[model samples]
Target: MRKCRFAPGGIYHIYNRGVDKREVFISESDYIRFLCSLYRFNDIAPTSNLHRIAYDVRGLTSNISDKPDKRKRLVNILYYALRPNHFHMTLQELIEKGIEKFMQKIGTGYTMYFNKKNKRSGALFQGTFKAIAIESERYLMEISRYIHLNPLKNIEPEFREKGVENIDKAKDFLLHYKWSSFLDYVSIKNFPLLINNEIHKGYFKDASQHKDFVFEGLFEVKPRTCKGIL
Candidate 1:
């Protein structure tokens, strides 16, 4: 586990996978539980039972991000995509050490949930989550598209190397995939209460524009592979 240098206002791409490259999320409920942690554990305060907490709104985000601190947040979850074995997130630290604290909570909380559900007692994830700072807007824009395009690998196993075979098919899959925040970012509102979309929204003219930006990358862009820490 690398000791990540998290500073206030810095944006980074953080990712981790299951231990031994195993599947961490084996079912739908498993994925949703982790997603709930993304909402339930962002606060500076400690809490549990994500199954009950995600629905409360808790006023953590209150639909007003980047505002005066009514609720102190550890980090701003700009974007995220949850794969079967791994997960990816683009985050901006709201306070110093925010990312580190947030990741620890998420890792610990989700491991407990997963282990209990499966009747296993062991670490679920690999080493500490790895982070890479998004140093430029170009990288941010590219990473946003890159993250959204991740589902395409399920459809076209070699899409990144061979390029998308059918752009229409690619769009259709992404339009329906609910695990990622891609739908919400594109005005679909799959999970409105789950993420703070404002920071990334500022990069685009509108949700339609954001959707367009991601769609265009299917055939035109070949971003570097976003690998798991495991």
Candidate 2:
């Protein structure tokens, strides 16, 4: 695991993969459950009775924030993609270590749920989650666009290959995809129980501007990659 700066109000690209190359999400239900955890951190529901009977479990707990007295919510989900073996999220940290704390809570909560539900044990993820800070406004918007376009690489590969020509339709697909925060960013839906509103709104000027910004990047954007700490 690499060391990351836990800066306040910072935007970060966080990601992780499943143990080995095994499927992190085997079905639509599994993906939905994970997405629900992202939004409802500290409020995750307990595993079902059927899940309890399948495997021994431990470390189960609520997904609530640790700083009960903090007036403002920390960690805003800008965008996310739930893939089969890995997942990615772009978030703005409202409080210090908010991303770390949020990920820790969900990771612990989900491990127990999965162990029981799948009749498996041990760890679910490879190790600690990785995060890369977006140091500039340019990177922030571009990274968020990349995160949202991830699912389209699956559903509309041809469009992606030709560049973001049909991104409006892609945006529509994102809105319909229940597992991502795309809808939250676009103002199509709101899930305040799980997401921070003010922090999210800070990501864009407006939906139309955001859409145009993303589409422009499709043709001229340079590929950016990160290795190790941000």
Candidate 3:
């Protein structure tokens, strides 16, 4: 196993791409499955195989008595974005070794589901995920802006380099983008269950302020020049 210097109560930007730059998410279902894994696999307790559980309970109507116990989360997922070939997350360790344990579960659980669905795989991710410690408040806010604006690459590939062509169009695109936590940050309630908003609350006054922060930084924020740090 790769050793990580993740510390308790520390924030880190975590990311990984697919093997050989392959597409890890081939379709909408693949994205949904991965999102479900993100929600289901953060527990400190061992869980039954998610794929198996879903299959076993297929077509069954749930009774009112089937409520499961609340999960003890390993880490606090501040924000996340899923792309076709890669993904990014802003996470804070909640306990000792929380980030490592959470990543292990996410990588292992999602790989099994993805490989089985695609019917061919040695490894889905390139290798161990990369992490960069957020050492300052300014750095944390900048990284958050970067992660949120990442989807603009799909529409405006040069936005990061030269700035957005049409800020209005870019903002609209981000507002409707479904694969990232951008919507949640903007108070759209897309995937509120997947994130812990305590950290974000301390940074932005509210959703409107958060949206303003993202848009206002478009001109000043430069493209990430370093590898494995965004």
Candidate 4:
């Protein structure tokens, strides 16, 4: 079946798994590299040496800017999480077809780096990746929570099998988890290029409200409830 196309300005749950469900991150460094690539591609850092040439000067100079000499460009990173074999992200597109370009850059850039590092051939991901547009503001928040909770299913399966007294502590483990955007959301660790602070803050109109939502969602649902999404 043909997959759906991502629309500009739409919030999508974008994800991909390793081929054969194998471990994509063999070491902690691999995870860091992958996350760095996300920020790098999203224009998170000041244009890299090459990016400065490709998209900044030569690349954009041809495209006329809407504001006099200023070139028109749109791209931003919203939220993302990294796991062993898979990853998830919530993105807001700023330009027409920006999502397509962004994903292509990330995929191609990471694959080259991963293959060279591991001395492996072929693709790292299973396929072209999947994206589901978040239909409501409610789902937007819900899915973000879901993405952050993915690592729990992998690292702390016991929290689900046996009831833990300190559910807050279990959730705290997630807060400190460096592999996902959970840290970014809480502002404990800042990943400047990985996410757009302005757009991300908009997800939580009230900090207390968002925290309650995440906490309640964690406890109310059986921990095993995440099996499917993971």
Better candidate number, 3 or 4, judged by lDDT? 3
Taken over the whole model, the C-alpha lDDT of each candidate is 0.78, 0.63, 0.79, 0.65
Q: Candidate 1 residues 1-230, lDDT tens each?
A: 45557789889988888899899878877776777678768889877456454432223335323345354688888788877888888999999788889999999988988888889998898887888888888888877887787766767867877788898989999999877879989888666666787778678888899998899888764455443321
Better of 2 and 3 by TM-score: 3
**For residues 22-92, could you state the per-residue lDDT of candidate 2 as single tens digits?**
77788765765665556446322333332332221111112323325233445777667777777888778
Model 2: lDDT equals 0.63
The residue pairs that clash in candidate 3, if any, are none
TM-score of each: 0.86, 0.71, 0.88, 0.76
Worst 10 contiguous positions by lDDT, candidate 1: 55-64
Lowest lDDT block of 10, candidate 3: 56-65
- Alpha-carbon deviation at 165 in model 1, angstroms: 2.2
Q: If the candidates were sorted by their TM-score against the true structure, best first, what order would they fall in?
A: 3, 1, 4, 2
Cα RMSD to the true fold for all candidates: 4.0, 6.6, 3.9, 7.0
Clash tally, candidates in order: 0, 4, 0, 0
lDDT of 3 at 47: 71
